[model samples]
Target: MESYIQISKINDFIFCPRSVYLHTIYDNFHKKSYQRTPQIAGTIAHESIDTGAYSSRKRYLMGKEVYSDELSLCGKIDIYDLQTKTLIERKRKVVKIYDGYKYQLYAQMACMREMGFEIETLKIHSLSDNKSYILDMPNEEEWQKFIDIVERVNNFSVAEAKILADSKKCAQCIYQPLCHPL
Candidate 1:
């Protein structure tokens, strides 16, 4: 069986295809004992959002639990609302830096779509300032484009070149040494 996919990994692929390959394909994550402020803050934010004390009828799937065989995609959504039957993907302030979030969100959207869900809405909740932004799904042409992107990711060859771009943020990653060599 293929390993479960994380919706966030889809975004990683979009941000840098090579990064996704390294993280997912090679299973190259290293253990980091140090807890960074951002991760700590994100945990706090997630706690506020995840407790489900605010909303009635809360249902959630995380980590390996969220999956889709048809789309051949899977990922942990921070929170899923069973009441409205929508996917509420949470992001800290940091996600604003990446272009891959769209792909990640779209992958979730695509999976939900495939699961016969009448997704009433797709909201990217920003925990930074406590705000939610609705992502408008594209029209026919754009939908096709997104599908093509998904197909491309699904069919990506092992021979594709891997490039690791330097980022200060890599310091926070346990996989930093493997991804960016000295």
Candidate 2:
């Protein structure tokens, strides 16, 4: 059986493919002990959704595990609004809606649509800022870009100094010690 690409990896893969490469090579034991401020904040913000508390009241799907055999992608979506047919992803905060996020949302949409779920809207809610951003549907060309990114990650190779990593992204990366892209 072919292994599925994780939906969570879409952001990391776009941020820096090396992060995903380092992720696959290391075990969860090392990652378990690794916690940064942003990750901690993200976890804290997700508590309600993770425990299905938020969905219970709204009649929504909280932390729903979605998978697509066709796309070979799988991960838990934060919230699926049954009333609105919206696939909503929440973050601790969102200063700017980055491309990585848009791509991640696209991947989620693809997975959900493939799994026979209704998705008419895509949104990202910033928990801290209490803000929400709506994403426009990607054209075929844009969707193709995401597919190409997945292919790159699926066939990823570890090579030092070859990754096109930004200095800002590299500094914030959790895998900096292992990847050392700086």
Candidate 3:
């Protein structure tokens, strides 16, 4: 039997399959060089939400985990407004705004949907630019797209393939030496 998959990994794979393939299949991961600005911004944003001290007039919770026997997904939701019953997913980045973040957020919303919670909205925040985008959760048709992506990830896990030789992405991975012999 295959091991269970994390919804976050699905998001990671979507961001860049090469990264995911290295992280999961080869057990390779890039080391964090230092405490970066993006990481700091995310931490502060989450702390503010969890405390409910922010002047924003929204009843929300931070860092929620939605799980199921068939699938388990967990992440820090920046804000969940009780009035609107929305789950806010946030990302703080200096450069690229990858779609992987959206995929990851959507998976979390799907998990919440499975739990019978009505998610009114899914929000993404770009800290650098101070802009927000709302992902409409009321739309059922959108879920089909996510389902297809998830299935593709599942299929990738079963296929037997060796790691590519001497790739830069491999060098940064923890399992580099094992997967690719230099």
Better of 1 and 3 by lDDT: 1
Better of 1 and 3 by TM-score: 1
How well is each residue in 87-140 modelled by candidate 1, as lDDT tens digits?
A: 767777745634465566667766766766556766787767778877676678
Top TM-score hit:
2
Q: Pairing residues by index, what is the TM-score of model 1?
A: 0.70
Best by lDDT: 2
**lDDT value for candidate 1?**
0.61
Stretches > 4 Å off in candidate 2: 30-32, 160-166
Give RMSD to native, each candidate.
4.1, 2.2, 5.5
Name the lDDT of candidate 2. Answer: 0.80
For candidate 2, list the clashing residue pairs, or say none: none
Task: Please report, in order, the local distance difference test score of every candidate based on alpha carbons.
Answer: 0.61, 0.80, 0.60
- Model 1 misplacement above 4 A: 1-5, 25-64, 94-99, 164-175
Clashing pairs in 1: 5-74, 6-75, 7-75
Model 2 Cα lDDT, one tens digit per residue, 94-177 = 999888898788888888898888899999999887999998888889889988987776676666325554778677887676
Put down candidate 3 lDDT per residue, 109-133, tens digits, no spaces: 7677777778777777777687888
